[model samples]
Target: MTARFHTLGLGAFGLGALALSACASQGGEAPRMAQADEGEIVLMIGLDGLRADFIDLYDAPNLQALAARGVRAEAMIPVMPSVTFVNFYSLATGLYPESHGLVTNAPYDREFDTVFENGVSTQEERWWGGEPIWITAERQGVRSGVMFWVGSETQIDGQHASDWSVYEHEKPYDERVETVLSWFDRPASEQPRFAAVYFDRVDTVAHREGPEHPLVAEAVADVDARVGALVAGLEARGLLERTNIIVVSDHGMTEIDPDNAIALDTIIDFDTVFVPEMEGRGGAGHRPFAMVYGEPDAIDAAYAALDGAHEHMRVWRRGETPEDYHFNHETRGPDLFVLADTGWSLTAPSLWSRGYPPYPGVHGYDNHHPDMAATFVAAGPMFENGVTVPAFENVNVHAVIACGLGIEPAETEADPATVERLTGGRCPAP
Candidate 1:
């Protein structure tokens, strides 16, 4: 079937025209294979904070091989703010941050009038509201598995992935890969129809050391080797061809010079901004850019003050955020959100005292920045071969995966064109 593009409320440049050309060039039929079945296993490997340019810089033989074998997108544009929790939820729910409600790494719940930070354990109720892919799969009687997704610990719609693990930010990369292989070894009866694995070392290392740093390059090469190993293992067991493999990332990284640190004292009142309990020790959210939680009136005044005083920063109100943001109201976000200028970063006072200089790479910039574009690649029986499509919004991932699984998408905000591309234009409405 020929893929049709439907333009949503978001402005359209040439995306629709490009999509149409993509379909027409393929003779109105998405690639197909003999193993195309409903219950085939789907594997998604998330390499956190992997930028599109990394592909050009690094020697990723395995990733390059995957692209050579199957479909690859030039880049994948993450949702607004482009933070971890926000984009991860966007991938799982196929909804923008606004619809999924996870606006930042640390969000404030306006409903309960409370704030949550990185350290807070996300309960089933607090972390997730909309149904994720795993939950929807389980409801359809198809088992699913997750290792360290944003809200894997949470139970959605009274259902969760059959096998799951808690979110641990500091876990070793090798251990995470091993766990996923072990899950694949389980008996077919208990095996998951869908599985997701996350790796943080690349992003973590990049944040501390610049993306060009040898440590960061070493981490990226390590992830690429791990990908090769995982694919080889599946091939050895005759599962590689049967299982669809999707590799993606939350967002990309950019260099930050220490000389560019924006002093918090220069922008807003340090005394009025209440430091919540869940913030990290020396993280960006803790020092120069505190997630302010307080009365709405006070928050509004603070936003206005910062807007006028700081030329490099911008403050967004709870509900007045741009429609493209997809943040789920202020429920899990701060009363006010602040973003620093391109080269500027937030730092704690103690870090300077201890002689610890800030790192040179970061990723929490606005989504429009080209450096923030993440990577997306897919290889399996169901995907078209050697195809490189133009960049699209990251929220469309949820719907694309759902289509591959022959399941209904849990969220409706995904672009229809993505659904058509993934399902061979066979998706039904949510």
Candidate 2:
């Protein structure tokens, strides 16, 4: 079946066109997978917007089998904003969004005087910072391949993944799987030790059909089928036993009531304040949180307009954001943050004028909310079988993958305890 995809900047197939162009400009050739001294392979699969509990909610026998045979986390806590690009980079770098500098999927950088929007803008490497695990592995002479993982397109720190696909939604899932298998077929000296594959249909279905809709269950099953195929292929190649397969998602989805959306214009007089780099309304990416930019006085008014407008939403200055979020870093943070309560979203007045239909589901709520938790399951030589580990932050995943692939983990914010829990006390660093 052909997967229908939305055009959201964060998880949409619309960016695939731009990604194709970028790849063509970069010579349109796959990078040579450099072999690592250790033959151990690590495959990191990201199922975007996978709810933490959905694995059990749906008939995903493959995922169930994975959990039964390998270490599975009770929950995977995502970073603040609980958005796509934010947590994807966080997971890749083992750092919070504030540290990595890709705070939002569509962050506006004041220094560069640009916005890192969902599509073409992400192609700019300047928008990315912090060393991703693939870059770390590449630096250590290990080949890494990324199948459309966030931030894989750009030339970060003057390097790209050894092998990667330009984003293209038209590419069938089976084709993606075949491409991954082909990577392993390379000579040992050119085999990638660390590889990542991403799937967006589950998240897409969640956004259009709500997380609780029956369609989501079907989507989960489809993804599970893909996972099963991947495992089967690895086993066929005699690589399953040696490969560390870590399946994860950046964040989860929540149902959004169409009538519960708060319009920004009704709350704040746009004439009084300038809100730039704002998404939602009719925009592709809509969620529970929005980034508002304006002068200091204007920011105060924007905050006041929505402070009591909705019981489910809250507004704050970027610095005033909760410390637990770790979002108060020095780059492109919004002057004002407006966060909708769970299952709520902030929209534009124009949307109301146009009779805009609310998204069936959305995310970007407080990371601490259970609704925002993602998925984490690992099965491979590096993991202890049948172990259910306690929840850990997504930032610690990079270190775990690095350890599995025998690459030295870069200095990161991952707590020692978090690593120990995931690695069964076999963490490489103290």
TM agreement with the true structure for every prediction: 0.83, 0.88
C-alpha lDDT values of all predictions: 0.68, 0.76
- Candidate 2 Cα deviation (angstroms), residue 424: 0.9
Candidate 2: segments with Cα more than 4 A from true spot = 1-38, 276-286, 351-355
Error of 2 at 40 (Å): 1.2
Q: Which candidate achieves the best TM-score against the true structure? A: 2
- Please write out the lDDT profile of model 2 over residues 1-430, one tens digit for every residue: 1111111111111111111011111123343332232366799988988899999888989988988889998889999889888899889988887777877777777787666666686678878877899998888777799998888988887799999767897688888988998887756656677899999888999988889899999999989999999998777665687788999999988887777867776778666654552433236234577777777788787887777787878988778888767765565777788888898777775534344466788888999788888999998877888999877889888878877765567767777667766776565333
lDDT of 1 by residue, 52-112 (tens): 7786788888988998877787889998777788788778877666556676666656676
Cα TM-score of candidate 2: 0.88
Please name the candidate that would achieve the greatest lDDT relative to the true structure: 2
- lDDT of model 2, residue 287: 53
So what's the TM-score on candidate 1? Answer: 0.83
